[model samples]
Each structure stands twice: as C-alpha cells, then as structure tokens.
Target: MSWITQKLPDVLFIQEGPGIRKYEYEENGYPMINVRCVQDGYIDMSSARCASMELATTKWKHFQVDEGDILYTISGTIGRSAIVKEADLPLLMNTSVVRFKSLTPDLDPKFVYYYFKTDLFIDELLGHSTGTAIKNVGPSHLKKMDISYPSLEEQKRIVAILDQAFTHIDKARALTEQNLRNVRELFESYLQQVFSLIGDRYVEEALDDACELITCGVAATPKYVDESEGVPFLSAQNVKSGKVVLDKYRHISKDLHAKLTKKNMPKKGDILYSRVGAGFGEAAVVEHEFEFSVYVSLTLIQPIEAKLDSYYLKYLLNSPQIKSLARSSITSSGVPNLNVKSVRKFLITYPALQKQKSVVRSIELMESEIGNLESIYQNKLLELDTLKKSLLQKAFSGELTKNMGEAAA
Candidate 1:
C-alpha cells in the first residue's frame, strides 16, 4: 500500500459510458465504439456502429473518443482495455465501456494502457466491482486505483521494449494457430480417405442394422433447482466430436432422474450422438460407470456387441462425411435437426470385424498423436502468456529499464 502511494500521486480523469440508445446510431455518421472494439492492445473499428455526428456532438460531447485516449471496459467484461488510435477517432463510447484520459503529462497513455492490462490492476478493479449477477466498477473505483509512476523517457523505453517483444510473441502465436488448423484438416482428410477405401469384401449396411438400439434421450428436462446438488445431466453442448465434455454440466434431482430414466438410462459403451442444435451428428461413447441423464437433443445409440465396435462407431459418426449427410438429411425447417428414423437410414460401409479393429487402431494412433501435439501447443501458448505477464510486472517495477541500460553499457 505504501509502494502505491509513493509511486502514483497524479490525478486521473475517468469518464463513464454515454449509455446511448439503438435509435441514436445512424447508417452514415460518426463511429461509436463498444466494449468489443477494445481487445489485445488495439481498437478494432471495423465493427463499430455509426451514429449521427450532429446528434452525438449535441448529446454526448463529453463522451467523445479521441486518439491516444485509453478505451476501457468497466462493465460486463471488466479490465479489457485498448489505446484509441487515429483510425478509431471521431467515435463515442457506448454504455458498457469507459474512457480514461491521464491528466498527468508525465505518464504515457500507452504505458497506462499496458499497466491496466497487468494482473495487479485487474485484481484491484475486480475487487472493487459490485454486483450479484454481473460485476461492475464505476469511475469512482477507478479513481482510487494506484499505479507505478516513472520518468517520461523511462516509461517510453519500457513501452518500446514490450512492444518489440509482443510483436514477435503475437507472430509466433498466429503461426501456432495456423499449424493447429492444418493438423486438424489433415486428420479430417485422412479420415475421409480411410472410409472411402472399401474392398469388394466390404458390405453396405444401414446404421440401424449395426445398432441394437437407437433412441432419443429424455423429453422432459428438470429445472435448475440447485446446480451442485443433483445428478449430472448431459446436453448437446456436453457431447462433442469424438469426446464427451463433462464440464459446465447441468443437474437434476434423484426423483427427476428416476422419472427420466424410464425412457432410457445411459450406460458404458452407449454412443451419445447429438441429433439437434450445434454439433449435430457428433458422437461420443460413454466410457464411464457413472449414471447420467441426457437431453432430448442427443440420440442414444447402443451398437450391437458382436456387429459393431463402439469406438469405431464413435469416430465414424463424427466424420465430416456423416456430419454433412446428417445436415443434408434434416427436414427443411428453421433449425437443423436429425430424427432417429433419418439417422437410422444412414448407410454404413463396414468391413470384417478383424479389419474393423485394424482401422480403429490406425485412427486411434493418429488421434493420439494429434492430441499430444495439441497439448504441447496449448502449453506453449500458456507459457508465452505467462511470460508476457511477467514482462509487464518487471516493466512497472523498474527492473526492465535497469536491465536494458546495463545490457547497452
């Protein structure tokens, strides 16, 4: 606390959002930046709304956004901030954001923006924010926040060092993201090739012929009485492509589960296929022993023990070909949906049981390799992010400038 008082003593001018209405925006007028515009140290003006220049000036003159001013988000998603650029000029702040202009000329706006991105600043802001459902921190709270103050030249040097470091870091991240995409596309392409390669010995059979049971999940959903106190309930969101996501799961009472289970109780080896909504056609085999109920949007498939392998069927259902077919089979409706009958009609080109095992083995190897690589990439990304935060901390603590001077000498 003494460190903050000693370092930061200048006045800070903070302005809340204009709280403009939808009717105030115009097709051909001045730009209006919202919380979405401020991200990753830059203001993206492409999606900003245009408002009547005359009306904005008359009503929201105080909220006028200028180049070099810091655009900060104060509500909904707090702590995200960006420095306003020349391209983002001639704009106004919406209700969800606030503008901060440093009254102290010694402080660099970019330095202040970078400081706001630090963990200390964010934690402080979050601590002061008040709300039960949605947290919010007003200008009064922001004004009380403290920050390190250095010489103007020292601040600029630190900013330059950070700017250079981040440029390289961002470039590496972009390449990693592209590589991840390429790896996924390669896997999908190989998947299609594997399925397409069928010999004369292979036979075409309806999906229903290979499955002992194909049925929809529970029709009635239990209300969210208490999230932590009930049995796990699976939905379309919980069922991913080739995987079952258990996080963010809803719950139902024991009585409701008993009632819902009357339709069907999910068991180990049962394939949970998404029949409606996003991720339609994706499937995952339930490999756990825990009891859980699923929503109606997911179709439960129990493959014949002798006729089909559950793991093989899971990969097949998640393939691009089957996903496309499922989308095409949907009845002309407002939302995409696949019924049990249509799903049953999907053709399955199956090989002998032994050959099926060989194919599954091959695909599993590729999936495992991809999963490992993804884990490495994700860890590296996290490391890079951590390094960035560490650099920010050092820059504000005066160690960054001190180290740079020693290296130069």
Candidate 2:
C-alpha cells in the first residue's frame, strides 16, 4: 500500500474551563484552556482555571484527557500538543484541543508528540489546516491523516531515546527562561530606582522634548496586496511578549509601501506600541528596517537621540505598570485605542546623560546574558528535535534496538 493510505488510531481533546475571565461573566462553565498554557511542551498551570463542575460536566464532556494522553490543539496553533502528565488526567480539555493515542502500540505516544512538533509536521499540519484567521482542523480530519510507524518495541526504543535527550533540552530551556525572567525583574527593579533617583530633580517636559518622531499608522485600512507586491507590514502580532516575531508576518503592495513611508517609516530602535483593542498598550522596540504593513494597530515613538535615550524610554513603556496605565487611558472607540495625544502625556523622569547611559548599559548586559542563555536553550531544543526525527526514521526503518528492556531501565 502507498504510504498515503497507512492507518493509525486517532483521538481528540479540548480546552476546558476558563483560564481567566478576560471580561465580565456570570454562569461559570468550565474555564477554557488557552494557547498560552500549551507553549513549549508543557501546559502552564499558572493560568488554568476550575469552573462549575456541573456545567463543565455537561459542556466539555466531549474531550476528556487521561494520564499519558497526548493532547493536540485543533485550531489557531494547529497540531501543537502536550503529553498529559500523571497529574492532569482528570482535567477537561476544550473545543480547540484534541486527544490522540494510537490503537497500535507501534506508534509511541511520546514519538507522536515529538513528530507533531517537527518542522515537517508543522508544514503538513498547516497545509491541511483550514481558515485564514487562525488555522484549524477537526478530529475527523486528523483521523484521516496518513501516518506510518514501526514495531512496538522499536517505537519504545525511539521514545526512550527522545525522552532522555529532551530532558537535557528541557533543563537548559528552563534555565534560559529563568534568566530571561530574572533580567526582566532586574530591569523593573532598576527602573524603579532610576525613576526615584531623579525624582526631585526631574524636569516637567513635553514628550516631544525627547522626540525625533511621534505618530501612528493611518487610521484607515488602505488597499492591500500579498508578498508578490513587494510590501511588508508589521502588526501587533509582531510584538510577542516584548520581542519581535518576524517569522509569521503579512505583506502589502509597493504602492502601499510608498504611501506608508510618506506617513511613518519605522527605523531601528523606534518604540512601537499597540494602539488598538485588548493589546492596546503592548510595545516592541523595532530591531530591523522592515516595512510597516498594518498601522492602525500601532503607535510609533522615535526618541531624540541627543536629548532622549530611546532604549530607556522603550523599556519604560514596556513596564507592566506603564502598560496597565496606558490600557486604562484608552478613550471611547469601537474598541479601546491609545491615541497619540492622550498617551504621549505619559511622563518619565529625566536624569543626566551619564546616569542614563549607566542604566542602559546595565539593562543591556542583563539582556546579553539572557540572550546567551536563550541561545543555548534554543539550540538544545533544536538538537532534541533533530534527535527525535532521526530516531523516528530509524525506528520505522527497523534499525532501532528493542533491547533497552528491563536491563536498560
């Protein structure tokens, strides 16, 4: 039979219960699990929730995950999943998730999880997934997917190899993540001190005092063309937890690019803040000369190089407190929006150039250390993935050893 017709057991899962209440609500059904919890290979319990048992029982009973069950997302992130550890067997999953376990032991659950995580799997998943907003594929669609594997013992061997390798990857990633978090905390602490150190000596100045440019994208959505048009666009999506994610982005036409440059062209180090919706105050420092695609969702802050330190101001705006204030300061619009006139009123204490340089350098050092750790972790992660794919190829090709039995454990 052609590899396309191969069969294996297919299962489904879902997100259950509200992770958190983003808006007002009364009847508490099961808290919905969100994409946030599924990042990396683990479900971040930090944001999960419990809802009314009776309601949850009725609404989310469709997709129940058990211990060792592998849960994959059905929408948005398409094919992203996590192994249900021993602790979370009873928890209900939601509509966007699916649980799968192969009927044939030749398909190791761990192997499946790793396979789904690969660049190859992602490509196939995206190709099969439906929708323009967020990708999605139903359980039936998943069951129909052609997958081939090896003998049960061979599958176990591959899973064993992967588990050992990824444990190291996981630890390295954990350390890097910790370092990143620590740097963020350090920045916050030092910023507080900086703001207070210059408190009494502060100058009350207009935002333009430190400005080379301050504006937002056109409020109107003009004509848009695909990447063929040779225009690139940046949106709130580019700003992910204060970092720019250029991998998945949109493009526009050459004509539209010309029009936007006539408006506001982003330069390296300019602070880009979200101007619309729930992401109203989020910001990312521009790191490249990419063309701006969607403007209505952002506010650009270009600081005066001589008078204002753009890096310092960018960090200030990225602070959680400032973002909270910016979100609250949104005016009445269809959705909340951070207007240039209203938001620029945000004030920061100015210190002497030397002090400013000192703080910026400190933050820069912290960022570098964190960046190094992040690189190690990311590389380890890639290595683990490569090992997994190799193991899969071996197992299916009948080269993996099945002798890791009671003796190897």
Candidate 3:
C-alpha cells in the first residue's frame, strides 16, 4: 500500500449505499440488488426484490450501479464483493451494502475485486469492524483499508494467473464434494436394502419383541453441575445418527446422576435413541464406559436376552425405515416425538441374532470405508483453500511475477 499509494493519481472515493426502507420495496418495480444478490464473484438477481420507480427516480437515482463499479457488503455478512457488469446497471442498493468506484484509470477494478478475497483485506476489515453481535463497517472504515497494486499490465497478469488457478481448484472441489455425497447416499441405500427382507428367514415384529424394556430417560431436570464436581449429562443433542457427539458436555453431580438413573443404568452395549424434536429416532450405541445421565429427551433401550445386538438396534434406529415408523407414531402436534409407547410398538423385521451381527459388521465396514474417503476429500479441500491463500500472498508480494520472470529467462 505504501508503494502503490505513493504513485496514486487520486484518492479512492467510497460511497455509502442508499438507505432504502422496507416500505419502498415492491414485487415489481426497479430492480434493487442487496447483499443476497452478491454471490460467488457475481450478482444473482433471480430473487432480487424491486423498488417503485418513483422511489428510485426520486430518492435513489444517484445510487444506481454502473458497469465497473464494485459492490461490497458492509453489515451482517461483511467484506463480500462483486464487480458490476453492463447487465447489472440501473440497480439500486440498500445501506447494508457499499459501492467502490475508481476515480483513476490506473487501477483495474477486476484486480481489486480479487484483492478483497484475500486474507489481507479480510483481516483489515475485521480489525476495523464495530459491533458486539453483528459487525459493521462504514465508508470511513473502508476508506482506511489499505490496497496495493502493481502496474495495470502486471495487475492483469496476476488476475489471469489467479483466474486459471481458481477454475481448476473449483472443478476439483466440486468433484470431491459430489463424491462425498455419493458415498453417504450409497451407505443409506445399503441400509435400506439390508432392512428390506428378501427371504422367509426374517419375521416382522414389534420393537418391544426384540427388547426387554424400552424406557424414557429421567423426567425431572437435574440441577446444574459444576465442571469439576459433575458427570457428563447426555441429551438429544449428544445423540446423532449412528454416532454420539460428546464434544460439548454438560455435567451433573454424582448424587443427582445416581438418583436420575436408579431405575436403569445406561451401560456399554446399550442403545440410546433420541425421542424428541429434530433428532427424533437418531440413535447411538453406548461404546464408552464413562458415567453419564441422560435427559427426558432420550430413551434407553434394554435389549432382550439374545434377540437383538446393541449395534443392530443402533443402526436400525438410524435407518429411514425406523424414522418413518417413528414419524407415524408422533402423538404431539407442536413438537415431533417418539414416546415410550411408540418405541415399544414400533415395527421391526429381523432374522436370527447371527444375521443381525452380520448386517452390523457389514454396515460398520462400509462406514469405515466412507469415513476414510470423506477424510481424504476434506483434507484435500483444506489444502486447496490454503493454496489459494498462498497464491494471493505471492501475487501481492511480487513473488508470483518474479517466478514467472525467472521462468521466461
């Protein structure tokens, strides 16, 4: 910035967006582009609202966007920017957004647009942003944002390099994301197939037939336990589909935990199923020996002697079939729920205990394979993101062009 500002033709002017009101918005009028319309380096106007012509001409006529102008979000989702195109002209903006127009021909707007995507600009914006909950930046804060550039031709060269790199990176990312989704869907389809019986060996029975007891968790809310003097308290949030997330834990005193679970202690090989709200039917096998007390939002299932394996019950509870059954039995109107009766009466089709174990083993193997692939793709995505940041740093520090020059030599 020190070097680039030294050769400036004119100080950059920053303008605030028009303070358009909700009343000024209409179903059909002059198109008004807000922050939502600015996405992925382009303006998406398919869902953009409109303002009455009278309001646009009378109050916001001066705020109309033109080709080459840069629109930046200043509140809520801060620092996202997009360069205006010819088709984007004559659109009005609200106060949540701002516009930046170069006063000199020396600076290339396209190059500047890429700069905003860099960590340098984002760090600066965060430093100047004000607000406890929702951060904001006004024109004054934007004016202080430091931006450096090389000659126009050099800027164009950098933009060209980044553009090519981004295209390749984006394509790889999309493919990886799709592959991840495919693996998940494959697991789901396999689950449905395994549960869908083909032979007479398997018989359909109520969920109660396979379990000794299906009971709800503690009805009374336990007193809040201090971190040092309490045991982990499990709730619906801790039980995810086919897994238990113990990351964010709340604790209750050992005395309270004792009284809460005096009826039945949740132990290893037990299946814990969420019975209420958004996580209804999601279940996890108790793999850990750690002491924990569950809330009323969860149900503790005690499998009968040799009828069901805990792992099989966990997977069955997570299957689409079980979820559909649970939905059908939801007696509450306001909040979704799978009550004790629903759990006891829920239908299940199963074969011998050995067959259930075989299915469980197969599912675990598939889960492990999918998990490995997911990790690989996730790590690759992280690497690509890091690569982008590195490229931006090199481009700004002249290292990119220096390497290009050396290659030419």
Please provide TM-scores, in order, for all candidate models, with all chains considered together: 0.86, 0.62, 0.75
For residue 283, model 3's alpha carbon misses the true position, in angstroms, by 3.0
Q: Number of the top candidate by TM-score? A: 1
The model with the greater TM-score, 1 or 3, is 1
lDDT string for model 1 (366-406, tens) is: 99898888888888788778878888887777678646533
Cα deviation at 250, candidate 3, in Å, is 4.1
What lDDT tens digits, residue by residue, belong to model 2 across residues 60-152? 455455677777776787766788787654566655666675665445678678667666556766777889998877665665565655555
Q: Candidate 3 clashing pairs?
A: none
Q: After superposition, how far is residue 342 of candidate 2 from its true place, in Å?
A: 4.4
Q: Number of backbone collisions per candidate, in order?
A: 0, 18, 0
Give candidate 1 regions above 4 Å deviation. 1-10, 20-31, 45-55, 132-134, 205-209, 219-221, 225-229, 275-280, 326-345, 402-409
Query: What are the Cα lDDT values of the candidates?
Result: 0.80, 0.65, 0.80
* Model 2: ten consecutive residues of lowest lDDT: 11-20
Model 1 clash tally, residue pairs: 0
Task: Name the candidate, 2 or 3, with the larger TM-score value.
Answer: 3
